[model samples]
Target: MKRKSNIKVIRIPIPTPTLLPHTTTNSYLIGNEEESILVDAGYDTEDTRKLLEWEINKHGLARPKRIVLTHAHQDHAPGVRMLIHWMPTILCHEKEEEQVLSAISPWEEITLIEDEDSIKVDGEEIIVMHTPGHTLGHVSLYIPSEQILIVGDNIVAEGTTWIGAPDGDMKDYLQTLQRLRNLKIEKIGPGHGKWVHQPHEHIDFVIQRRLHREQQLLTLLEKHQQITSKELTEIIYQDRIHPSVFPVAQKTIEAHLDKLLKEDLIQYDESKSSYVSPHF
Candidate 1:
């Protein structure tokens, strides 16, 4: 059944799934005066879709007007086709079109959100802010009228976000944090965390924490002189590296090294797996 909030929102927690525990998915049921919309869909699982259907039916929500994915990660988009069967406009950032379109769903449909583009849903404008870093196409949806921001994997209140191995960029992620700071948001819907009631404070914490970590990586690079990106990450992350996140951590470190190299801050010898920072 629909859990009613004064503003017409029902939060449905979808399990993120794994051998270990982490924040549960916090997909949202946002209803306007009459119709409704879903923020992120949990993992691509039969159970997830089934639960979603139950929530929708309970609310007596008309077919959702749209399924807005915060990013294209499979964990968030699997239910797109299933949900759309009810008839909702699917929207994702233009930058993410490559990743989203590449998803290869049986249903071939999606609309790219242009930069500075805002889509009107029942007179409420949900502006798309292009924030790359976690993924090249990652974007957050902001509703200025409500001071609410729907951020997907940008920053999770319960845990640190990953630059994540395999294409997650540290520099871009940092820049995105700065951009979010300008929003002065009051409420947050993180992809995998508890609802954030203290938005600006949390943004500051994430930004400062990332900057401190960046400095730590740079310092370690200089001290070690020559080390592969993997070696560098091991030294920097040390015991904090969990086996689950090690691969992701390695990729993120490499992205940082690449950016540092571009700025003449570090160098890699192709003959070896090591890289050296100018400070060292």
Candidate 2:
């Protein structure tokens, strides 16, 4: 199931409004003369479909054999239904398939992928990496031959990816970052923003930023005897984020708190209804 060695990936950028700072969601077309597949069709609008068709026609890409979703986020998976008429097999990780199909009508031809599963388009092998954090079932695809990692919200090219609480775990995010850093990636094709030319730097920067944010959060907590997640969010992130995005920022803050609490560096004071630094 590998694509031909000569077929290069074509990135079809589509405009989609999500909570993210970026304006366009990148849908990648991977294929060759024999077969092709699409990754992350985020925009389902008529205009988006037109653009996709235009790109396919412009580049002379064969109709895709399947559509692979990296995650089930609204910004990434919503467009699947629009392309369902194309009759491509919709594929996602087993852990993420349910979430991916939650909003769309069920179809009998869905394939659940797993880590190390290689999806061959033409003849190229696209390897799956189950890198959860931004979402529990989030995944990143690695094309070993091309050394390109298609990082779906796991690593945004510009603004940091928000790790939501409950479903999003900071600990898992950090682990995933580490996992990516260990890879031999040359470039990162993020779901949003520009392509990352140097993945090592991008991955390192992302991980360091998260660690630094945690440190800042810890310092903020230490400054106060006790602070609720809301209070903490107000003091640490409210000013930094727009009012409309404050809610999402709070969820990320809560995720950070969860990590600290798990590490015994912080504790939840049920009586005070606040988070307390163990040092305090």
Candidate 3:
């Protein structure tokens, strides 16, 4: 566990069976000694539960009375099952209710939250911002006093966060980044990996990198005339990613295609099962 800022912000990196390069999901303890909130629960495992409890005791902070979820991802929300003994009130965005419910038992208590809603921990306010893109109900917590943002999977310490279809939207993700960039954030505690100290610069890099990928898709479509998302994924990320991640890369490409198609920047050839540049 690591502490940040003048406030009692403890980052508890709980081990989980997450994706490669990220073996643990960050569960944060934010509040004063009297009352606190736990953000994200990691995966559902006895070990994860014990580690979290141990960390809280070790830090000498009160057991979190609330568990605020950023989203309903497997690695982030499943651990609530183990914490059912604690009976902490589970809170998530309204849009995420279905997913969160599906992950936990029916008897668990849940509260729906929305954008601009404030959660207080010992008089300190943590504002919830609906930052979708990673997921429809993804939220990032803002601590005005410390100028810190706790982003789930929206912004990672390493490579960019994956924005694929069904749950992910490239367009919404890009807009979320822009919105976060406008905030006066001093540091960001992401769901995985180390903390992000340079918030704006990192947000800008994520934005530009996504735009650059979109441009790459457009350029590839213009040259190839007609290309499937699978083909585009191969050409764009060939050798840079492992075969296991190809499906994810393809989905991201499809999301980009969806955005471009909506903007009339590209056209889809339904009969050919491929996308083409408008000029083509």
List, residue by residue over 1-280, the lDDT tens digit for candidate 3.
Answer: 2234445788888888766567888999887668889999999899889998888888878888799999988899999999887878999999898999988765369999999999988878889999999899999999988888999999888887788878898889999999999998889999888899998999899899889999999889889989899999989997788676778778878888898998999999999899987887
User: What's the lDDT for all of these models?
Assistant: 0.73, 0.83, 0.87
Could you give the candidate ranking by lDDT, starting with the highest?
3, 2, 1
Q: List where candidate 2 sits over 4 angstroms from the true fold.
A: 1-4, 106-108
Spell out the clash pairs found in candidate 1.
165-248, 227-274
Model 1 clash tally? 2
Clashing pairs in 3: none
Q: Name the best candidate (by lDDT).
A: 3
- Candidate 3, residue 115: the lDDT equals 97
Give candidate 2's error at residue 127 in angstroms.
Answer: 0.5
Show the lowest summed lDDT stretch of 10 residues, model 2: 1-10
Q: Which candidate tops TM-score?
A: 3
Query: Which of the two, 1 or 3, has more lDDT?
Result: 3
Candidate 1 wrong stretches, greater than 4 Å: 1-7, 18-23, 164-166
